[model samples]
Target: MILKLVSYAGNLFGFLFLTLSIASGLYYISELVEEYSEPTKRFLTRAIYGVIGLLVSLLIFDKFPFKLTVFAIASHVLYLQNMKGFPFVSFTNPTFLLSCACTVLNHYLWFKYFNDVEIPPQFKFNPNYIPKKRATFSEVASFFAICVWFIPFSLFVSLSAGDYVLPTAEELKKTDDPTAQPKLRKRTINLVRVAINNVRGFIRSSLRIFGFKIAEPEYDRLSI
Candidate 1:
């Protein structure tokens, strides 16, 4: 159930809705960016940009839109009261279906908070803060490289957590059992296996990304 929500979704209803949202999101953002470019439009536009940034952050994170969005909306109302001076909760998509709800909520929040503010231009959205630089091939290659690396690194973290952390039973065992020595040895052995597996994954992924064909998918998958 949870996995179904996180998988890649291209179109809303087949390809039609996907194309529409992408077009609309880009247009809405571009128009907002252009309008916000003017000196007097700083406050209103900054709020809009913040909303867009939140949406992108959520989509990238890939969670369900509704769950995290409710959190973001509630967070926004709190922000107006507390004024954290930073966007803390508006990021997290939960899933692609969420983009719609998030976008609407963001616009509503922008209007509510900044529709009438007349803040000065010196403190506003710099292009640097909201990067618009076109990503090159190297950037994409690096991204895929990192994604592949992340899968293994994440597994390694789970597997090796025992090394830095003692199981509850072991801590209790150490007090009364003189045989606690074997516990440490078991921990070391587990760490060694994790290290070997993690390194193997990284090397295998790195080789595959760069087009090297030597490594087999499975140990026995190798051809003689």
Candidate 2:
């Protein structure tokens, strides 16, 4: 019962992790599209080339299982198609739909491969002679993290949302009601600056949680 409960919990956690990772990856892509559409496109183009090259090399070497190799090749091809008009497309676009299909197919194929039984062809009469093939939780998790699921997550991150744009300071200033624009006013710091400060704050907070006392950095004031 305990082992079963643990297995169930682990599966739940893994599902949640994948869901959160995909969501964050999408959000990161959305933000990139809002801020750096051109750069994002260039990066995705470069990535697709790398992926294609890698897939070709893998096919030539045939290091992975035949089924997985075929899936990888197909996934890369779909990824290449996704690079077309990348930063601009409705969710209903054929390329987007195909990419989504490829992502799920690739993930399922990998999962199936990982769970595959390696029974010998000659051991049909003796079932007990066949060796058990079991993957540990860590091995399965790492495989998904580094290989199977990562490609789709990366594709999600590389995609740009052409419809979304950061509001300009001029646009923010155009509001007649001052109280209504309080949030805009509060955003005085640039996104980059806020990100850096947030990172610093997180690091400090983490150190504090670990019982480590860290002195805050002091900036020099100009004496004119």
Candidate 3:
């Protein structure tokens, strides 16, 4: 069901997801810059625990989409751990790669939007490890240039190569019995109906669930 939506171009939906991801990413990044190099383990650990519990529920429920969502969060945690030492600026710093990292962080923030996390301050820096200064407007403009150029460029290349993947949903079952066909049709309809309602419910819930919560005490401990 989740994959079905993703199977298509998903332009608006993808952009919405990206917006959520970017907003979350930027906020988390801002918090990190303001105080900590990383989030406090308490909040992070809670997120880990929540993900674990979600995984357990997925196992019990045998829900693939549920599992994928949890795995996505777990993916970010692993990603963060791997890139923790990476400096924001480098001669060889791959912008796309960094963008991907930023995307993951954004995804995590979206996943945990309602929750509070403690960002720990970065107090330790090697004497020789000179951090890059904040990105200026020109620097920001230059970075956007890469994004503007790359996405369209890739689209063009894909068109030139005639390489675009069209996605389709996994077939649920094969049918034979005439009576069973109606039953299957009915079931599919019911599933679609249920999914729609769930989505509607989520929208309503999301509307009410606004605001970013940072763990105040943990935020205070950011400075070493």
Candidate 4:
């Protein structure tokens, strides 16, 4: 009973982490659409190409599922549709909405694949010959980090709403400190800096847990 309870709790925590990551990813993409327009479009286009390349390689050399390849390719095409109007597209555009849905589908499929979770018993039609292949944990984690979660994490590091309103040259000369950052820019920088430090600290701690003697570096600034 205790082991079962622990397993259940672990699964719950994993589920929460996965859900939050997906939410953060979608939020990041939406914000990119709002702010970075052209650059974001280019990035997504390249990302889709990369994903297609990976899918093709997998098809040739790995036992990856066919349905997932189709889903991923379709999702990228849907995402490209959002770039058609160059940032003028509505959030409610049908293609974009469908892309979000496909994003969730991809997440679900990859999560299950990486975690080695079996299909639920009710859904197991062919009990004797179920496909059991799964990606290694490292592969899945790296994929999520680069392909799925990079935007959200980078947005946390780069977005500066307050710095949007720049001071004029005359206003800059009036300031006592010429080097002083705008309030919003300073705040955003601090937030990103602290976040990066905190992530470093967490990685250090986790490494220590695994018997790796990583030195914890002291930050000059406050960390989260």
Candidate 5:
């Protein structure tokens, strides 16, 4: 019983540590991308072309199914449409939503393909025969990291959330001031930051519901 309890505690700690680590990494990447938005946009555009080329090559070599390859290429084309505005991405935009859906669809299609085993002619005739092996976890994960999730993940980090909220009076005054330097308000809105803020607000609200008084800080800051 002691060993089982210790094991459970260790697993819980490890899971929390991993979650924090991933969140920190994403936050860092988003900040870095915001700082170099132009360069990141250029790199992502080139990456899209490279991915499309790779898909075409795979199709020509018969490495992947024709329909699957064509679909992947088409999806990449749709991804290009999202890049027109580059760093400012509206979550409500149809193109962005469609690209997100395509990402999931591509992962599902490729995963199913890789998971299935192609039986030999002799094995096809034998009803009792079963394949002993399929694509390993590492293989599938690597494929996803490189080919499937790369672009979407990069986009998430690079793209800023749209300024959906109305500007305050001070902001309007700043905009009106001829001597004041123009600020890229849109670029300042990081998706990771927005997500973190929302999560924090939710937690605070939940705590209030439980009769816990958490002091709301003036600036809910994140260490980049």
Candidate 6:
């Protein structure tokens, strides 16, 4: 019983540590990119074009399956649509959501293709014959890093959560009460900042549940 309890505790600790590490890294990258949004946007635009060219080259050389290569190219074209409002992404946008779905689909299809081994007719009858070797873990990982994940990861780092458009003076004038003060606009922060805030909030709540007093963080006052 003691051993089981210790194992559970260790697993929980490791999970929490990993989660915090990833969240911290994301927050740092998001913050850094927020400062150079224009340059990052330009670079990502060029990168998307380059990826498309790579896909075309692979297709021309018969390196990748024709249908799969075409699909990959189409997905990158969709990725370009997401750049219309670069650095200010709507999580609910159809184009953004579709691009995300394509990323997962592309990864799944390519991974399956790489891992599959097809035996020749002669090999099928011969017990000693072996099919070509499957892609190694390192090769699969590198392919995913360069082709499947590059754009999506870059977008995540460069895109902001969103910003509020201040109400126009003409619209504000249409309000029923001229004397009433306008409601405060909620401050916009990047996704990384939001994730950090949520993690901090969860920690505070957990501490409170354990009968410990925790002060609220002043993250709300700072701009991302």
Which whole-number lDDT from 0 to 100 does residue 59 have in model 6? 78
For residues 76-146, could you state the per-residue lDDT of candidate 5 as single tens digits?
89988988998888778999999999999999999888877778788888989977656578977976786
What is the full ranking by lDDT, best candidate first?
5, 6, 2, 4, 1, 3
Best by lDDT: 5
* Candidate 1 Cα errors over 4 Å, as ranges: 1-135, 161-188, 191-224
Predicted candidate 4 versus true structure: per-residue lDDT over 45-105, tens digit per residue: 6766776677667767776668876676666666666556543433456875676677777
Q: Compose the digit string of candidate 6's lDDT tens values, residues 1-224.
A: 99999999999999989988988888888887888777877889999999999888877874678899889989989999988887778878999999999999998999888977777676788988867667678977986887789998888767776656567687689899989777645334676676677767787899999999988866563334
Which run of 10 residues does model 5 get worst, by summed lDDT? 180-189
User: Candidate 2: RMSD over Cα atoms?
Assistant: 12.1
Quantify how close model 1 is to the true structure by its C-alpha RMSD in Å.
20.9
Over 154-216, each residue of candidate 1 has an lDDT whose tens digit, in order, gives 222222221233456647665776655433322211222334445566778898899998555
**In candidate 2, which residue ranges exceed 4 Å CA deviation?**
1-29, 60-62, 124-143, 158-224
Return the lDDT, model 3, position 1: 83
Best by TM-score: 5
Candidate 3's residue-wise lDDT over 76-183, tens digit each? 454334233321222233643554555555445434532324332462444554444444567545533432223222211111111123322333244444364322
C-alpha positional error of residue 35 in candidate 2 after TM-score superposition, expressed in Å: 1.3
Instruction: Kindly provide the TM-score of model 6 when superposed on the true structure, using C-alpha atoms.
Output: 0.76
Please state the error at residue 44 of candidate 3 in Å: 3.3
Model 1, total clashes: 7
lDDT agreement of model 6 with the native: 0.81
lDDT of 1: 0.40
For candidate 3, what is the TM-score?
Answer: 0.23
lDDT scores in order:
0.40, 0.64, 0.40, 0.60, 0.82, 0.81
Off by over 4 Å in 5: 118-123, 126-136, 164-187, 208-215, 218-224
Instruction: Judging by lDDT, tell me the better candidate of 2 and 5.
Output: 5
TM-score of 1: 0.18
